[model samples]
Target: MSIENPQPLSINSMAALVTLGKFLEEDQWFPQLLENKRIYRVTYSGKNGQFVCFAQIMNKTSIIMCMEETYESKVQW
Candidate 1:
């Protein structure tokens, strides 16, 4: 059987994930988090309508890597 390896996360990306996880845990929303294929997407809204940060969670590690922004806003604040 072939083994698949998980990607390593950058320092900034890992930190952001930890922070986001903590916030979600405190808010009791962490359980609702889901992994969509290789990317973990969370529905969030800011000053704009809606946005999502696509991330990959490393297996057997606490690292989370931000891949790319799934949504873009044409309206400039």
Candidate 2:
């Protein structure tokens, strides 16, 4: 779950990125385009709960990630 980029990321952020990459690579996620930006969506059910994630790679520099747990959890972006 480690990113080989210069940007710093927290442990949880790294894990999320790894999950996003895996889903994308496996062609298991949906991609949307908005204002010429490509956003990826990953949705699945985990042991803890149902999870949905949105990730947008911005300017090839940083990632904007959002996740919502469908188990009485607040959304994080």
Candidate 3:
């Protein structure tokens, strides 16, 4: 799905997106969402513990909607 009014991503989210974008730029293999817009799942470790980041890639830009999973639920990408 296309973003209607894509807002500015948070500082942390922007940093994560930038890191993933760099990786995608180097490999040229960004994640492609099936039936949905292109999506990417980035896993990282922090002070708290391990975490997963989910984002949507559009026009070479990554839009992160949510951070770590709050509860057990199947992610549609």
Candidate 4:
């Protein structure tokens, strides 16, 4: 059956949205993936470990860089 209305976001989903909004606004992390790729994938490392995120080529213009990550050890890139 087709539904006319959609369900509201769960509490966890809402929290994720807010967290992602803050992350995108304040985090300046991006990966230098394969050459000529339209999308870039990056991993963010924190005290809790690493998580993955990505951005599209067209979205680069609107992305804001609030901070850059510093590693205690040397990284490949």
Candidate 5:
């Protein structure tokens, strides 16, 4: 049996998600929050892993973003 090399792909995918989160905030790309009521969660998946990019738009020029990932081999977040 041939072992699958999935680490590189998973890691790359994780990095991309993180980059996306940063991009969402860079240059004030996100739209202004409508009275504390604007949030978005983006999900991405690879061969053996998946991740989420979470961002909250606070106001016209205020936003926060965070990324989280999980792999098939990992037991915890």
Candidate 6:
């Protein structure tokens, strides 16, 4: 759904558009987002409790808003 029709999503729409992996071009935005206070390091809870990742935070929101997750993350490229 996300690839075919990328648009604003809502519960009333019956589903949401989500991406599995982002493109390399998108990584360019991360640094600026960090400087703008829109993204930061997060524990990114996992089975082993030994992971760290970055999350884009919504304006005037709490970090706890993110759900518990386990991602096969890559820290250094």
**Candidate 2: tens digits of C-alpha lDDT, residues 22-72:** 767678555443332245666666566676777765333447565763544
lDDT string, candidate 6, 4-66, tens digits: 343333433221111211321255322222443334444433344554555543323323234
Give the runs in model 4 whose Cα sits over 4 Å from its true position: 1-30, 59-77
Q: Tell me which of candidates 3 and 5 scores higher on lDDT.
A: 3
- TM values, all candidates: 0.36, 0.42, 0.35, 0.30, 0.33, 0.23
CA-lDDT, candidates in order: 0.51, 0.55, 0.56, 0.47, 0.48, 0.35
TM-score of 6: 0.23
* Deviation in Å, model 1, residue 68 alpha carbon: 20
Candidate 3, 1-77: lDDT as tens digits:
33555555566665665677677557754443333324575566554556766667445454676576544354333
TM-score of 3: 0.35
User: lDDT for model 2, on a 0 to 1 scale?
Assistant: 0.55
Model 4 lDDT tens row, 1-77: 11233344456654554555456556665444434333345667766456565543222132323245546674443
Checking candidate 5 for backbone clashes, the offending pairs are none
* C-alpha-based local distance difference test score of model 3: 0.56
Who is ahead in TM-score, 4 or 5? 5
Clashes of each: 0, 0, 0, 0, 0, 0
At residue 34, candidate 2 shows an lDDT of 39
Better of 2 and 6 by TM-score: 2
Candidate 2's error at 23, in angstroms?
6.3
The residue pairs in collision within model 1 are none
Off by over 4 Å in 6: 1-33, 44-49, 58-77
